[model samples]
Target: MNGNRFGRLFQVTTYGESHGEAMGVTVSGCPAGLELSEEDIQGDLDRRKPGQSMITTSRGEPDEVTINSGVQDGYTTGTPIGMVIQNKDARSGKYEPYVTAPRPSHGDFTYSAKFGTRNWGGGGRSSARETVNWVAAGAIAKKILATQDIEVKAHVNQIGDIEAPEVTWEEILEHSEENEVRCAHPETAEEMRDRIDEYQKEGDSIGGSIYFEARGVPRGLGAPRFDSFSARLGQAMMSVPAATSFEFGLGKEARQWTGKDRNEDWEFDENGDPTPVGNKHGGIQGGITTGQPIYGEVTLHAPTSIPKKQTTVDWETGEEKEIQVVGRHDPVLPPRGVPVVESMLQLTILDYMLLAGRINPDRLDGQVGEYQTDYHPRSPDNMKE
Candidate 1:
């Protein structure tokens, strides 16, 4: 409950359960005068919503977003922006069987142990559905970042054992959304879709990783040590439900590399600015941004809820039971997770920009307490001079 909020300056607080009335969020610290509409947020929600394709859950929620407050004349008012997405297709009856038994590798047990009781309907606040609120808030952040020329994007790069070949930014923009798998490589996406179909038929699930990148982020947006750019980004990526691992440039692979091999040499750019020759550090050096692209991957474990029979104990009866998690659920995660990853990237970058004072928290125009010479008329006496 206390951890529902994220960020220091640009704060985002979410509420509601997965199967409850609706999921909502209050986004504070957004500067006034920025253009925002429900449509801007709905596009991202559409990508993350369930029932997107043959591989996703069958729940038919439209995931339409409604902006409840904090806008007038189509611009943010610098107040808390309230938005909500109602749960139209949540079926509580299917989850009743596992209410006491708890699902394997899920937060059901821990939530019960800590809260003494839980909603138990579609996993409540512990559900990945909560990310709907995240993607909503991230849409606003992305809009704000766009004003500063920052861009965030992601693609499903790995599905189970099948991995797509490395792709350029242009390829991701063009091909990532052309298929169901959200992989940038078309052939690899087909293979990934087939693999997901195999798992769905078997009533099992698979895991994969998403590659995300942020470009046009200014340098010196983060601090050293605990507040490093990479540190905050890691926290953002790891917070995604089912995410098991996170890595940046070189990442774990850096273990096999010597200091000399991993090190990136610096040189002066044509504009006379210092720049790294290579991006082995993923655009960060000494925990701060270096004006290069920030790129990384987040690995999500297989979705735990599956129709395949799994054993668990019924806490209410104090007896063992075999449970088949019969319900609409995704056979794999990365396809739906691509947008979530991009959202997190945008949110993290915007928060850091606000913290670094690179962006004015009061307004997007960055003109605070300054005279509006263009709007104000000079006195008649002064005009004679």
Candidate 2:
């Protein structure tokens, strides 16, 4: 309950249950005068919504977003931007069986133990549905970042044991959405789709990883140590439901690398600014941005809810029971998670940029290279009477 909010200057607070009335979020600290509308957010929501394809859950929720406040005449008012997405297809009846028995590897048991009682309907706040609010807030951040030419994107790179080859940024932006798997590589996406189909037919689930990147992020946008850029990004990626692992450049593979082999030498850019010769550090060094493309991967565990029978104890009856988690569920997650990962990256980058004073917090004055001086107050002597 207390941990629903995220970010420092640009904060987002979310509310609602998976099977309750609707999911909502209030985004604070956004500058006034930026163009915004429900349509701007609905696109990202549509990607994360259930019932997208054969690999995803069949629930028919539209995930349409409605901006309830903080805008006037198609622009933000710099207040808390309130948005909501109603749960049109939530079926709580299917979850009733696990109310007491709990689902394996699901949050039902832990939530009950922590809160003493829980909504127990579609796992309540523990459901992946809560991310709808995040994607909505992230859309605003994406728009804000876009004003500065910052772009964030992600692709499903690994599904179960199948992995896609390295792809260019243009390929990621182009072909990632062309298939059901959201993988940039077309052939690999087909294989991933078939693998998901196999799992769906078996009533099982599989895990996968998403590769995310942020370009045009300015340097000096992060503090050191606890507030490092990578630290905040790791927290953001790990916060996604079902996310099991997170890694950046070299990441786990760095263990096998020698310091000399892994180190990136620096040189002067054409602008006479220092630049790393290579990006083995993943656009960050000493916990701060390096003016390179920030890239990483987030690995999500398989969805726990499946029709395959699993055993658990019924706390209410104090007896064991066999449960088939019969309900609409995604056999794999990375396809739907592509947008979520991109959103988290956008939110994190925007927050850091705001914190570093790279962007004007009150409003964009519609001028290039005037962010710091446009709205500044004049001296008392210079003020008109």
Candidate 3:
């Protein structure tokens, strides 16, 4: 895809269809030798994998990742890294109903309009299955960012009408993984699960909010104007399939505040660094990091293809009909989306870090050895306007 390539540095180009042979990524400009392992990538993949919760699709796939190049003897070689994630849970038969009738709020119609044909099976590239590559690349980006002491974490903040309490970092880290909903607040997670269960019984799906934070990121990440880091982050986040809306910091809530309230009061730390009394800027100001925790939230729509019947039109017959989609789908996806959101942020962070000289020499200290590394391009740039 023309828009698949991302980054000014540490660029990642994702490829493959959702139900294609396999989906994978080609990462250019990653500093080699920062302790590479399948577990590092798999840890995140397992979370993003389906069949994890009562609320998610029942399709069983481990979403295992296999690294093919750019590392040797257990360290990076400062070369491009490539990895592949096989798709095993695809049920092409389930999509037969949609062959002639495009599902609403999905890419089927747009893809067919764009290409004259679409992969009706498993939502094609628009499927959340595509994010397996994003998570894998983010795992690699985490390795690249070890030097800056930067950390990115995300959790579900809301599901349907269930909302989480304002949570502390300690609580978020402790409780996010404690439940299938991945809500940072203990009580809210329970409520989210209950709501999802209720929706499942109705043969439907629900959407929710996923919030994220990046701490200790040095100042100056995103560029301003055309290259504003915030703008880039917004674009990158919105690229995730099924992503409905995204906001930085106070986000939509900021619009309700006047300039006097919207402004973050400044403070001087003992280290003499600029600090804001509140994170109204989401740790970013003037399109650069502000030495505060970078924060944002992603809003996702409920998955399409619910078992319950919905109305649609047949493209060939021009006759509207009722359709009950039969296929595996996550009844609640925001909780599982936590890693994908974090991955997008991580990829952006490392990319800008590379351009900013934070990851220069294209190498992390002690990560380079005599091991040979490999690099290959996924495809030529589309260059389509």
Best by TM-score: 1
User: Whose TM-score is higher: candidate 1's or candidate 2's?
Assistant: 1
The superposed Cα distance between candidate 2 and the true structure at residue 318, in angstroms, equals 1.4
The alpha-carbon lDDT assigned to residue 278 of candidate 3 equals 82
- Model 3 over residues 1-385: C-alpha lDDT tens digits? 4877877677888887767889999888877547788888999999998888777788888788888987775666668888998888777887887878888777788888888887777888777787888899989888667677888888999988878888987777888999888988988888888899999999888988898988878887777887888988999889877788989888999879999989878889899876888888898899888878898889988877688878999998899999888777888788789999999999888888877777754566533443333321221233224
Clash count per candidate: 0, 0, 6
List model 1 lDDT by residue over 199-230, tens digit each: 98998999999999889998888889999988
Q: Model 2, 174-244: lDDT tens per residue?
A: 99999989999999999988988898888899999999988999988888899999999999999999998
> By lDDT, is 2 or 3 better?
2
Error of 3 at 72 (Å): 1.3
RMSD of 1: 3.8
Residue 385, model 3: lDDT of: 41
TM-score of each: 0.95, 0.95, 0.92
Model 1: lowest-lDDT 10 consecutive positions: 371-380
Ordering by TM-score? 1, 2, 3
